[model samples]
Target: MRGTLLFDGRCGFCTRSRDLLARVDRHHRVETVPYQHPGTPDRYGLTEQQLARAVWWIDEAGTPRASAAEAANYALSAALGTTLPLRFYRLPGIRWLQEALYRWVSNNRQRLPGTTPWCEREPGTCG
Candidate 1:
C-alpha cells in the first residue's frame, strides 16, 4: 500500500496539502514528491501537462492514478485504512459526482486556502 504522491512544488496550496497529508499519514504508506523535483515526473512517465492538470499517485507496482479524486482516495485509504468511503467513489452515479467536485476544487485552487499571489497569476506554471 505504499506509493508516491506527486504535486506542484511552487504552489502554496499544493505544498500545504502535502503537509496535511504528511501529518495525517501516520502509517507512512505515502511519500509526497513535488513534480518539479529532478527526474520525479519522468520516473512516473508523467508529462508537464498531466502534472498541471491534477495531482497524481504512482503505486509501488508502478500503477498510476491520474484523476485527482482517485489519487486522493488512494492516499486517504492508506491513511485511514478503510475502503468504505472509496467504495462510494466507484458507485454508478457517485463516481461522476466525486470527479466533478474534485475538478471544481482543482480549477479554483489558486483562490483556495494556502494559495500565493504567484499561484493566482499563473495557473499551473509552478516549478
Candidate 2:
C-alpha cells in the first residue's frame, strides 16, 4: 500500500527523523511532505500548528490518520514489511489503550525526539 507522510520540515529533529525513515524505507511505499507545503493544510484539513504537533499519514485509498506515537508504529511496521501490528491496532481493547497511550505521548512529544518549543505551549494545546 502507498502512503504519504506529512511532517514538520523546519525542525531539525523532524528533518533528521524523516531522513532516517527515508534511509530505512527501501520500497518507497511511504512518501514524505512538509506539513507547511503549499495546500498541505487544505489537503489534510489541518492547521499548520496542528500539522507541526504530530505526524499525519494518508493511505492511498484516502484514509487519513494522525498521531505521533502511532505514526512511529506505522512506519516501523511498514519498513519491516509486516502488517501484524496493524492488525493488532484494529482490536477493540488494544485499540483503545493504543490510542490513549498515543495521545499521552502526542501531548508530551516535546520531551521526545524531534520536538520543538512550539510543542510545549500548553499541556494539551498545540502552539
Candidate 3:
C-alpha cells in the first residue's frame, strides 16, 4: 500500500494540508515529499511545473496521477477505509470537476490561509 505523495512544500496551505493528511494517514500508505525536494520528480517521473501546480500520487503500478483533486479523493478513500468513493471520483465528469477545483485552489492559494504570495515564488522554502 505504499505510494508517494508529492506536494508544494513551501506553501503554508500545502504544508498544512499535508500535515493534516499525515495525521490521519495511519496506514502509512502515503509517503509525503515536497515537489522541490531533490530528485523528487525524477524519482516519481513527474514534471516540475506539474508538481508545482497540483499534488501528485504515484500508485504502486507506477502510474502517476497529476490532478490534485483525484489525488485527494484517493487519499480520502484510503483514510476512509473504502475505495468505492475514490473510484467514483475518478469518472470522467467527476475528474473534470476535480481538476477544475484543483486549478482554482492552485491559482488562489497565495491568498489562502497559512499561505503568502512569496510561497509561489519559492516552492520549497516559503512557509
Q: Which residue pairs clash within candidate 1?
A: none
| Candidate 1 local lDDT, 1-127, one digit each (tens) | 6788887777777777877888888888888777776676677888878987888878888767645888887877766667776787788998788889989988887777884433344555434
Off by over 4 Å in 3: 115-127
Best by TM-score: 1
The Cα error of candidate 1 at residue 87, in Å, is 1.2
Over the stretch 1-127, how does candidate 2's per-residue lDDT look in tens digits?
Answer: 5677877665556666777888878888788777766788887777777776788777776566745656655765676578766777767787788878767755665566763422232223222
lDDT of each structure? 0.76, 0.68, 0.73
lDDT minimum window of 10 residues, candidate 2? 118-127
Off by over 4 Å in 1: 115-127
Residue 40 lDDT in model 2?
A: 80
TM-score of each: 0.83, 0.65, 0.77
